[model samples]
Target: MDFDLPESAAAVREGVQAIAREYDQAYWDRCDAEKRWPEEVWRDLVAGGWHSLAIPEEYGGAGQGLLELAVALESLAEGGAGGAASFMYLLTPAFGGLTIARHGTGAQRREFLPRIASGELETCFAITEPDAGSNAIEIATRARLDGDHYVVSGQKIWISGVERADFLVLVARTIPAAEAKPRTNGFTVLLVDVKEAVADGTLSYRPIPKLGTNTVASSMVFLDEVRVPAERVLGAPDEGFAVLWDILNPERILAAASGVGFGELVLRHACDYARDRAPFGRPIGTNQAVAFPLARIKAQLELARLMTHKAAWLWDAGRPCGSEANIAKLTAADAAWQAADRAFQTYGGMAYSLEYPIARMFRDARIAKNIPVAEELVLAHIAQHELGLPRSY
Candidate 1:
């Protein structure tokens, strides 16, 4: 594989960086400190036409590859738009547009995809439940067909951007485990209208206060007998898992890109500080101790970036990339975590201060190890699917 980015990828990165340069560390710090959403960043991304680069061309998108998506995200981070993986930039395409573009019917795609591509619509994804975080098939959220509509009711924890979303790509169990051909069968995906559901009093959400990445609200949402039109169903009935499955690898690949980019940001900050800050008449970077961890972070981050690109390349080529995606996420998260820790150590007391953005990225990096799929679960997948080991979970 070629090491350099293609012309399209370069254009994507350049466009994204132009927008990201508008917001510096201080803006994100105030947003995180107040637990406020970054509306300014969101607006800039929307205006830049950077939000919908990956949806189908017919749907008002640029028809760019997912590698472009990763590049755009990384560009944002590298330009100092750090916390929340530049969620204001990438979340819509990541969770909302990609799934519908792949699996939605003509009408479903017609209604949502263009709006998403135009940055005129935004949505959240709901899958993880309070009771079933990792074991998705065992989820209690259910949708029952009732004449022309389906009644959906369930509790979803850590559902992001509920208040700001126009809709939710909701996963509900349509067939009970006992009645399914396989235990994983019978779940259905629905595109539920968030405003209508809430106005009718069928949905309510409480924002989750988080340690970092506070630009978007991580929410606990409760759905009580929400009515969704039958036409809102994504893919075939009881085939929701397959629709979700199409997006998981991309999600992992995107998460890997975010983590790897954040690692690069941290390393840059530390290296710059070490190069300039001198004590005892010599730059601190002259000391092996100060320089070594940054070097290690640089090496590991490049390794993660390569893995991520391989996975994204395979995915964009429409090849089976499950194992590669999982491995990329695992390695990138590890690299980001170590990078953040080293950044903290390298910055010393300043790391603890809110004045420095490194602390924010470091805190946010802590969440990467566990999200978009945990490292432990990625290892489980590598073992079971890649190494021919028995399924442990």
Candidate 2:
């Protein structure tokens, strides 16, 4: 419940921002225009150790909590875009390595965590299917047992970083739906080597064109009877849902934090434009029409920031944070959207022009409401968990 970050956390933010400042908006703008990934920035982050800040010290990481991780990611988004945050977190062990750390055995950790912490390897988590979407349990991907390996067959859409990742954390059904003890049962998690699968023609991928965050490539991946070593199975054979909890909370919180940063960046731009633009012999900001709404968005962003920090703190402390994480993501996404819209409106016709960064930030902010988890889904979780309403889905 601490309102202020500890000195160590503050130092992490300062260090990350210092490196991020080297890449200005113009550089990011060019990257976005070309649909190019930020390889230079990614390498710089890795060199500075900001990429491995969250991994445990024993595993060659700094062992920082999620709050510090959230702050660092938020600053990156504020400094650049969600692409930068994605590069930092997606490239790190947080996505798959953390899942393995929580549910992995000593052998698994020894096999993967250190290499992941050092950025020697990367993993992409494949869970979303075309038919399943948010209904993860409805996915039809199957992993059947073999002599010393499991044969996996499935299709996943919107799987990010697959082209560059060395391994994949895959979710597949180990038990048939008819025999599943619960609707969520029968799902299994496995880590598969991407190179071997592709070489064997068991895995294939095609890049998916997206509107934003183009720096991180997402793809439609197919796994046709891919063989994964038995040791690659994470947690139990049919307990993927439990294993996902360790990853999703951090994902939601990190997304919320990124939203807050984007909002702040928009607010700064809007305020600057409002102060300089003159209409009717007075600054446009003089009219309460523009100024009041902008002020409100500023307030909303601050409020979302508080909630995001709280959610990250609770999650890092090993407390149950499903409710808080949902609210944090919902509030921050809404606030960012509001701020981006106001920024667009404040910029008038110029807002629609690509020359101004607000237009891109607006598009990026809108995407925040949809991905990582949609706002509608967040509301559903809140209604059920926070208000004690019956589950809608």
Candidate 3:
């Protein structure tokens, strides 16, 4: 509502920017080409406490809200897409932390929060399966109670950070659809020990080769009767959909923020090139053809930023932000996609080259339009939830 960041928020944004400046486009380009994770830069973020900024102070985190988290993510992206968004992906476990904080038993929180806050443990979220994708109710992953532990067995695709994660905040069906209270019921959320799961051969993961974001590898993981202790379960069995929604809203908001930052980075590069590159003995920016499109991109990016901030605010205030978060992701993904296209056009031939950061951001931006939630699904949400239309699909 204020439309201005407070002093502490401003410092958080500025600090993230300063940290991101250490990695340049050239470094990001090399990492992408080599498909290497930015370990050193990630360590820098860990040491800076950037990874735990949103975890509660009582749990040894900075205890900031979603607005600050969005600002931090955007600042990282402002540095460059790969450079900034990598941290965003790395710190994704915090979304799980927030879910646990809100719903976990005191024992579950005590067991995981301190380690997560200290960066000794990193977590990957598992909800989107190959078959289920955005329709989470369709998730077939199953977790069955067996005395003191739950046996989980399922396959999850696009589960990021599994290679280095200490644990996973996993979602699986606990009751069959026929027995579920509603179509969304019968599911449960579990905090599984990654090391134990791997060591016992209950979980096997192979890195998913991806187009970008190589800093943290995505994984296709098979959970083969993995044993998650009863103490590790968060919230309740057969009622995780609500908790998953809370967790996902922040993920959407964070992704939208990173998209905003990436859009800004592309626009900045294009603007500089336009001001300096000459066509017809004058700056290319002099042509309305070039300048006008970039101007429109800048305007769109700002609008997306506002939507992202609004979503962040609502989530931070402990309000239901499903609609706002969905819209922010939809708008920001569109803006980033449009900005990437225009920025590439402004650069002409070089934009197609792997040497250019715009190309990488462009590829990454295209993914945002689909991953986490698709643009079509977001539009459907708006039509059904806000516009009072019947559900489609």
- Give the TM-score of each candidate: 0.97, 0.96, 0.96
Q: How many pairs collide in each candidate, listed in order?
A: 0, 0, 0
Ranking by TM-score: 1, 3, 2
User: Can you list the residue pairs that collide in candidate 2?
Assistant: none
Q: Which consecutive 10 residues in model 1 have the weakest lDDT in total? A: 82-91
After superposition on all C-alphas, the RMSD of every candidate to the true structure, in Å, is 1.4, 1.6, 1.5
Give the per-residue lDDT digits (tens) of candidate 1, residues 1-393: 578988888898888888777887788788888877777877777776677877888988888778888888777776776646546544588778777777888988898998997778998889899988877878899999999999998899998889899999888999987798988789899999999999999999998877888878889999999999999998899988778777678888888888887888878888888888786788889989989878988888888888888888887898889999999889988988898898888888889987888878888989888987888999999999989999998
**What is the Cα-based TM-score of model 2?**
0.96
- TM-score: which is higher, 1 or 2? 1
Clashing pairs in 1: none
Report the alpha-carbon TM-score of model 1 versus the true structure. 0.97
Please give, for residues 7-28, the per-residue lDDT of candidate 2 as tens digits. Answer: 8689988987887789888888
Residue 315 error for model 3, in Å? 0.9
